[model samples]
Target: MSALTAPHLNRWLIRLHRPALFVWTVVLLGLGSALMCLWGPLADASAEAWQQHYACAPTGPCLYDQAAILRYKHIYDYATMAVLAVPFLVAAWTGAALIGRELEQRTAQLAWTQGLTPTRWLLSKLTLPAALVTAGTGLLVLLHHGMWWASEGRIGSAKSWYDPPTFYAGGPITVALALAGLFAGAFAGVLLRRSLAALGAAVVAVGALWAGVHQALPHLWTPVTGVSSLESDLPVGNGVDVSTGLLTADGERLPDPFCGSTINPQCERLYDRLGAVSWYHDYHPLSHYWPLQLTASAIVLAVAALLALAAFRVTAVRTRGLS
Candidate 1:
């Protein structure tokens, strides 16, 4: 049999998945356009509305372009959600269409029999899709970041940089998550060999992975501690809160009594009884954003590599007899 080169295999893979390609392209273009609109016109309109709102008299009825502000907020929310959903979409498509369907239809087997090794077939299936997913996801993420940055401090309702959804959608971490979802779906497809089952498993796997990352993110970096006297309000600031509690005279951290400030006579008495001297906040500042994002992304990419390795191993085992 004549050798099936990489270009030939890639052409066949693209032909087989043309519909999926069209859908992905449409999604990218539509979302990118929305984000660009948000970054420029939508943000500017919302900012002007907020300026008008601030100009209104304190004690009199005033009118502002509420619709423009609400529209900007709604569009930003919807766009952020769409950016975050890319991973799940990639997971489902990779498992069901890219890998699982091919295996289920015996197309993979045919390729393996036609002078194409199972490993080469699997690589061909993944390579183009990974490249496309990365580029598309990265573009969306960059646009989301630009939109958020443009609205920052201008629109009153804009989500903060530290907001979880905004943070995920506006960084390279989303790109990592997309790639991880790709490998996870590929792993599920190779393991299950059924399109529907693989699709569910892949989505669930990505969900679980994201949950794990969310839970562990704050602890991934050492947090800055803010301390304040009991006479002051809580030491919490505009940052990601990891922990907030009371500190003893000896600096021992203790659970917060949830009482009001020491100016409140009743709360002061309670704090005296509890031997609480001050409030302490352990949190990540905005300065830590890049470090946290890079750290989390590295962890996700490592997991993706493992998943890819497992997919290849499973494929080898399944096709060993044919070889």
Candidate 2:
């Protein structure tokens, strides 16, 4: 029994999960390489194509490298989506293979007979994987951000910094999300002790976390208000829109009522009836990008910590009962 130690458990853990490690390595390398291409050559090619497209005369034959533009867009979309999917992948794999299988097959019980405490065992399960997930996910996000920055203003059709998928994939938020998924999966596995059931539950848990964050993101920070004349198109604010409506003379905000601009005779009549003088917009600007990202990431990390604590408690209760 003394021969078995934490190091031995960790080594055995890695050995038992070589296949997962290999697959994750492949995913990391593939995404990193693809994003690097986007950051350099692909973005350049697309930007050049757009330049040529704009340079063409209205009455002249146009022959820009449309293929290059499409290729960059396609690859960027795929890579961004893949990065966003990492959290779900982590949750599914961790729940199904890392903890659930051992518990279901009674192998985890056998390991406890050897000198490892349940707490130490759980730590061994989480520590190394958390490190790997953090490093890989962090690298991908950094690369994605670099690629996004390189394309800004250069690629006409490039996704905006606030685009939902781009924003999540290109920021620290995804790293926090991935970590949350890991702990969520562990908690589910310990609670369920069934691989498939845990897998589904873990995915659902992560999805719920993501949805909650998405809904709460705009409200996370104070938004700047933009007011414009009712005759102009809606207030010229272009970030995450919190709200848009008509503002009255007394500075009261009213719902837009889907009224068109004053160019429309009916819209002018409706505005007069409602006492609306101008359009008001509440939104986050580009300057608020880091604030939003950091706030959201911190919230997710806090949730991850809670999930981890819950997992440990569950493990403690179950192991104590067995003992």
Tell me, by TM-score, which candidate is best: 2
Model 1: per-residue Cα lDDT over 36-120, one tens digit each: 9999998899999999999999998999999999999899899999999999999999999889998899888888888888988
Model 2 Cα lDDT, one tens digit per residue, 1-323:
46468889889988999999999999999999999999999999999999999999999699999999999999999999999999999999989999888899988888888877787788999999999999999999999999999999999999998899999999999999999999999999999999999999999999999999999999999999999998886776999999999999999999988867899999999999999999999999999999999999999999999999999999999889544
- Give the C-alpha miss distance for residue 170 in model 1, angstroms: 0.5
Full-model lDDT, candidate 2: 0.94
For all predicted structures, in order, the TM-scores are 0.97, 0.98
Which prediction has the highest lDDT against the true structure?
2
Local lDDT at 142 for model 2: 98
Distance from true location, Cα of 293 in model 2, Å: 0.6
| Model 1 bad stretches (over 4 Å) | 1-3
